[model samples]
Target: MWLSGAMATPIEDYALISDLHTGALVSRSGSVDWLCLPRFDSPSVFGALLGTEEHGRWLLAPDQPGARVLRRNYLESTFILQTRWRTDSGEVLVTDFMPVKDRRASVVRRVEGLSGTVLMRQELEVRFNYGTTVPWMRREAHNGKERLLCIAGPSAMVLTGGNIPHGSDHRHTGQFPVRAGETVDLELTWYPSHRETPEEVDIDEGLARTVAYWQDWAGLCVDRKRYRQPVRRSLLVLRALTHEDTGGIVAAPTMSLPEEFGGSRNWDYRYCWLRDAALTLEAMMTHGYDDEAAHWRNWLLRAVAGDPDDLQIMYAVDGGRELPERILPQFPGYAGSLPVRLGNGAVDQYQADVVGTVMVALSRMRDRGVDEDSFSWPLQRALLGFLERHLEDPDHGIWEVRGDPQFFTHSRVMMWAAFDRAARAARQDGMDGPVELWEALRDGLRTEILDRGFDAGRNTFVQCYGTVEADASLLQLPQVGFLDYDDPRMLGTVAFLERELLNGQGLLLRYRSGTGVDGLTPGENPFLACSFWLAEQYARTGRLAEAIRLMDQLVGYANEVGLLSEEYDTVDGRMAGNYPQAFSHLALVRAADAIHSAEAEQRLRSTQPAEPMESSP
Candidate 1:
């Protein structure tokens, strides 16, 4: 009953459901188009997000044509999704979720009829290894319950519930009728093929437990009066991206969603970037999640345990080091973007800003009363030694540009910040370290950046030394205390960015393409995070009204479920790139915090008595 040739759903139409170990993207049409099992970086079992339905997908919707989606939203403070649909014959509500803290990975879908009799259809295609392998499926009975067991090379899945689909030509299909007040439940569990089929889950217990888990976690967030809903949801999203066992936070779930539709700018984002993870930690700690900071710090120690010289920009969710880039010829690509990639090659590049980000985050943890431990402080000292060794090395920079390396201004500023934080920690926290050396290095780097990285005549900082082009990363200079937000130089740089990088719709681009800087095709939508950074800048620099306007506009881009992708195509008004991106969500949290702080300060000032006109001079 499902259409094999149906067009892929728009990126924004997908809502994320995660158990903190892995995630699935369920479309508005009730299709599970993307899901990686066992881990966030694992091969997907449902790969229709990148290719056609023939690849893989799970669909559960009304069999009747013209069944309209009335509304869909995540349950309060949780990833549990509820979608209501209405048809000529009847109405039905579908609830989808993944159980938290469960021993096994599974997805639960329950359909309840609300009105007259209605017919519903379920279709599933199981393809392992990113749609390259078809699984062996068989119908069997487990504990007197009918179930469908699917086994591939090493991965296996079992479908058990009130209704099971029949198989034909390696595809499963089923149709069932339900009347008002009737409910049908279906649960899918993934496990190793060598093991026995997983038992059917208790649908009622799982739902209740999942809801409670999310609500409890969300309740821990400190209350905010402004942008409360968005900030809370964004924090929940960051938590969802974090791996429960390893404490690794991924950049995004789905990969190879083109930054530019039908373009080749796509790359995998399932791995954990040190910079991204540190930033995520900072965002969490800013809102009273110090536990996450300590957890991720342990992950950091394990990841970079060996020689600090061997530090990489990113690693696998479990701290894997060997991530070789490869093209999947099987996937025709999302929207015809070519050479769908797996395993980021940038993992091997030297991104100078990574260690700096980690250090800044750890410094924040220390400030928040997370005392430095024996291993943690020693780790910081080791990282400082590594920076001392590579102090002058040109890096690929924060964007991981594929072109020739350069002394990127933003990276240099972050490097300065690393040493600045280290020296301050040594002097203030009484932590043992080479404080004098760190202070000297920090000051010298500051001098060099101001001399060469800045364009004196233009009064704006360049993307890298020996260039006039502005970069969005420069917007973060004030974030790390490299400069004051309202400094004339920073204001000039913001002006330059507004003129050069603002797209037609007033959103900020990372930088102008075609400058031979990134060494790729000249195309991509405005990166969502950069605009958020701009919002933070505006909020901090006395431009409260402008900041509020930009903040509202940026928040509006979140989908109906308050989820954001990596980029937004203003021309088409659709989200592009990886869905539910951690970078975007974390930046949103930071921006909202900045706006709230600014608003609070403004209120405080309004209540204060005037300065008595300086007593008439």
Candidate 2:
């Protein structure tokens, strides 16, 4: 039977490897339990990580008991991972993750000797559709050597390695040993079932090409103001999460890794969020990776070329729109969380902020001089008109929830941003639109937001109209330049955040439980992105010492491999929620850049007039 003792909830023990099409998170314990193949949103052919290994897997590690892990880390700036383990006999290392190439199908594993002889185990279990379907498998010859092949529906994989295992349960099993002065190379090739097996000869050359591809991609980053290490790491991560061929960025690698561990707050983040994509593109562009930005912009245009009203806030990485939400009852879930989920149901919800976010991205594109397609301007006009029609209505906010729509204050502010930014784009870029009407609407929205969303008595903006709760999202006012950072109102919100949301570990939770924003069990670890936003806000408002103190504390929360999850359980000092969240990493870059830029701005202003500040605080 497959063992469960080696699984880690902290994401520390697991090293992630992906081809940017899909990814697999492999714990050091010889198990390949979590992988959604072909595409990030595709059904898992191996999901034993969330359930039992019986659910599915592609394991190839030492089968010995009592073996312990030594260390793990990415190979330099690339997504390739090296995991070392030590046992009584000696030590051995397993290098895992998919090989990166342009549109070809392959996953290469290279195991090199380090010490004395070490016995290892290899077990392969293939279950498609969340472990419900066993694919047809057979042995074949490629270049005179026998290779195992599996094909189910349209998905297919070819694994090449040493010491072919013998099995009768449709699962491959074997035991082998590795000693000093030897190397073993394995490759898992994925191609369409109808297509013939791909050409595969040397694994070492593929490994080198994979490493060089990522290094060259990451070397384009031009950010040098500050936080060089973390910035580069986040950039590497963002690059890792992106699909190389389509240039579509998945929100995260895995899905159903619940927010509340055993709770039902799990979601399929495999699809792309327009809001996330826009911010991600801005981050990439700022770091001097315009190629990704252009690709993403192209993806956006193709994904939303239909009616403006039909514009989904998200889409499949390949621009597909039909993400049907469904439950997989075959597997229990992570820690018995129940009803394992696939596909996102939020595609039908209307989020006003998505429009504003898109507008902001288009504006950023125009400002950066990134050339757009001929239809780009026309598409923006349709979206803005749709925004004009629905600007006054209350719908679901940025946080996709099932509860009744309420007048979320932040949503209105973004609507104003939509009009204001749209007007700016038209006036400044010579793009023709209803600039005059949009400006009037923009001023009117500002008036409405100031009158309704702000609490004059409390000197802060409420989470929504008539609500006194302070949301960590309110901290975004200064970052968006919706309000001045040093404004007394923003300062009051900052103080309120500290008073209400600050946990003992100096991280900020999203909000208090009493507010019914999200319709679920009202408990979660402090969101890492929100806390980082607090740091940036602190830096921007001239609370530099407080910013540094909080920033340092949060950075310490990263796993040993310099990776972070969506949330952090401060009480246990463990990561919670989704593993390697794009939201967390994206905001991290922005905040780090924000802090560094703020510090530079502060140093510059120490000699000039206080009003000499150039950009948003």
Candidate 3:
């Protein structure tokens, strides 16, 4: 499915539209080059973004190749995309969105004439099985309406509209004219080939309902005095990546986008990682989406229902356990990044941070008035028991390092947090549990970390038990209650990270790849989440001006539509890694909230009388 000579559009030039179950990426030029069927991890029905239009694409644009894109934006907090195109003779508006209220899986594109007559062109190429199979297409009448039906091995797609493109060389092409005050609608739907073809839906009505659905959900966010728009947009993206029925949140919608283009760092993030989903739930709860938290907790229960020792780091959307990684040779990948990947091999690795992350999130949920039933409490106790079995084991760590396992400082700290939260829950929250045992475990781990994980000469915590390299993850020490924000040890660690991890543009990299710690190529962009964590740390330690400056610079990296990728290439000034990463956005919300809270506190202090200063002895 790799393009032979076609030049693919830049990743930044595309916008996303989703139906909650799946998403479609549309370039500004009005070509939908990437779309998955049934679910986020399903096979692509339109994958031209990874290849070319010849592989699969549905384009609706001005017939004039010189048409200029005037502007594009989502419809007021919703994923409904509106792009206006201007030609020398006239102008037109293309509205794209996936209907959410309906059961049918479809995408609707409506073209409206905004000015004088404009010639429009429609091209349809439906390639099934990741663009490796061209479907057999034919024109037919379905439900007394003319439609273009395409059939492949087990999947079928039908295109219903007034202007049916004629077949030409296994592709469909047509030209139509729309005068002022005219409109044309096109809808494409997917269904199993064995089942009856689904009926068409009213595109206008569906768009209205979808818009309301998103705005209503977004309206629930607690008002933020600063960065409200971007916060709202990030929340929307997280919702878009979540599976509505299953309550499983995906890290990103697309797979094999590459952490470093044309490098071997590519991975599939379509499945639900325990740590990522837990952090996402924490973000949602912070923004007043407690209902989502409850749902995801139930999903976790089902996903990890078996023996705690057998639990995986990730699971499928429906709570299935198996996710074997494999390479898709057919796809040339984004920007010639080869061997597109599906599933994830990291699921099998032991990431000790995962259980601690989940425990912390559940603690937050409890603090927010979520009553933990027997099911949840017992499950947590069992997870703690599982941790007890591996108290001194090495793990893959938070970054899922492919190298030999090590006793990562961050992972050990998180395990301490897990035991600490459990003890607090039982003693303070009046929850039933073994509090004394938990406290002893927590204290023992803390002493061990300070003794073995700290580099006393440098006054900094190292990446692992023996390494001298510092990790940006140390910025999270205050966040998880391992240490005070202004603790001298933490401040020293921050200084070391700023000196070693910051790129020339002052953005933070996850770690120095050249250290040979990750067991891969020695290059990657600055991780956006790590940078956000630094902003949060600054705010907590009373460095208000420094925090504000870094927060502003970090948010500016978001694309034009307010979506952030996992990493940013400071040198090249473009996004890297998976597009619209959940971790990046969640960290953004927390960082913005920190700044808002700090500003409010500062304002209140200025209005009140200061306490009398005590004389130093």
Candidate 4:
């Protein structure tokens, strides 16, 4: 029920629409609050999500006061969003989507009158370069159709439809009344300002083709009776975050959505992180999407196409490596969060776990019958060589802490996983490599971890070699096969995490920030991905009841259209951090798969007859 000129809406109120290049966040009240053109990391054209409406936004809703959202949901198996609004006079439906396979990037909003005549309003303020530059506006005829064109610097966008808005004071405004059975369609297209303006798209044809493409992709998922809807939706979110042409998957479509609202914990997540992308690939591969897995693998090969010693933990969507972090001070951040940032500084930091994550995912693909090309295997060997040279190097760890580097237990275990997977590939799959050396290195890591990482007195593994802290990332130990889920050490670590990291509402925090481990403020919401990892651990350990209860609670946090953010604020009961986060959704898919597997096992046990009782004397 948010209105224009008001403070930004909660993170959960936004739904995502993507066309495989860039994405736009549409608020529940019918506003495009955030949109980056050309690519995921491009500058924003609708930056109202992070600042005032004057920054930039597109508002399309009823012109009447108290016109509230009745309901909203995405069309089945697709990112097409349909929202129904009810005013005092009548009802209307708004459909929003970005057509796939289109030449120009565009957003299509179609409005249909469902009841009595209702008046609709349209307001657009296009600011390029993250809301810093207002575009030069003009009206021109393209293909005999009058369109409003806005050009600024290198970016240009055209607004075309039956009802073109009139501009005044750098804002476009229009109003029209629609009777029942009538419809109106508006399209916004972005292209290079230096090039010729693009033509108007065929809305009906684009819509049909987009729907078919998504449905066809979703049809490839393996059938799951339990948690099917959320799984399917989560899988689609992961796919939506992926760039089709480059095969690079971004962590999220957003930049600087605060992890802690009104705090300095915000960081950009628009780039492709190797760990997140590899995990996303594994999740998709588990559900019968090997083609996507191979595509991402090819992307990996292209991204790390140089000396492995220079490999970065993340890269741009097109594999560009120069990501310099900077702040935009002109625009106030989301909910007063300051210093909205662009680009990720963590690209320069060494995270030991990333190589292990990539190796494990590639190994999974190989096990699933994916043949590595000439370039892929050699690149992996070079990566192992780099790892061998940096075997004793301290790392910033998986959370990418800004604090001093340490030999994190999770990172070390993943290092072990890298060698283990390489050895397995060499021995079992006949992949050429130094299997003996890999085995020796793997064993050495295991011995060192057991000797230094574990706290035998507490029967738990510590966060690092010298710290006694329990990190929620420890829950992933069993995930990488570092230990059995039911191992005493893992159980002890889980119990410690529950006691130390769980908030009042039983959600998990990444770690105790008060320990200065992250070198930041001590307040933030519980990370959704960590909680999902806990759920997976519970299911794997035969705690089916607990796992289902936790899974239900976590899944319930998803917004109206089955989208989850990076974290959930249990105190305020709202989502925090970036919207439609790839990490959160991919972890949800894995957790659901674990729970489904546990449930099937439980059913099989129930169906089995008990063994005949022994009649011993």
After aligning candidate 1 to the native by TM-score, how far in Å is the CA of 47 from where it should be? Answer: 0.2
Q: Lowest lDDT 10-mer window, candidate 4?
A: 1-10
What is the per-residue lDDT of model 3 for residues 1-617, given as tens digits with 9 covering 90 to 100?
A: 23533434766778899998888988888899889898888889888877677768999999975698899999899999999999877899999999996877889999999998889999999998888889999999777778999999899999998788999998999999877789999999999999998877777789889999999999998869789998999999999989988999999887877677677788888889989999888888898999999999999999999799998989998899889999878777787876778889998899998889999999999999999987999999999998999898999999999988999999999999999999999988998888999999999999999999999999999999989988998887788999998999999999999999988898888999978778887888888999999999888889989999999998898877888988887777788888779999999998988888889999999999989999999
**Tens digits of lDDT, candidate 1, 1-617:** 12223445788999999999999999998999999998999999999899887779999999896698999999999999999999899999999999998777999999999999789999999899999999999999777879998998999999988779999988999999878999999999999988877777678998999999999999999968999999999999999999998998999998899998778889999999999999999999988999988889998899989998898889999999989999999988887887799999998898888888999999999889998888988988888888889898999999999988999999999999999999999899898878999999999999999999999999999999999998999999999999899999999999999999998888999988889989887989999999999999999989989989999999999999999999998998999999899999999999999999999999999999888655565
Residue pairs with backbone overlap in model 4: none
Local distance difference test scores for all models: 0.92, 0.79, 0.89, 0.91
- Pairs with steric clashes in candidate 3: none
Native-structure RMSD, model 3: 2.0
Candidates 3 and 4 compared by lDDT, better number: 4
Worst 10 residues of 3 by lDDT: 1-10
Question: Could you tell which candidate, 1 or 3, scores higher by lDDT?
Answer: 1
lDDT of 1 at 587: 96
lDDT of 2 by residue, 39-104 (tens): 888888888867787788867776566577777788888888888877677677777757677565
Whichever of 1 and 3 has more TM-score, that candidate is: 1
Please tell me which model should have the higher lDDT, number 2 or number 4: 4
- Per residue, candidate 4 scores C-alpha lDDT tens digits across 342-388 of 88889999999999999999999998999989999999999999899
Q: Which portions of model 3 show Cα errors greater than 4 Å?
A: 1-7, 611-617
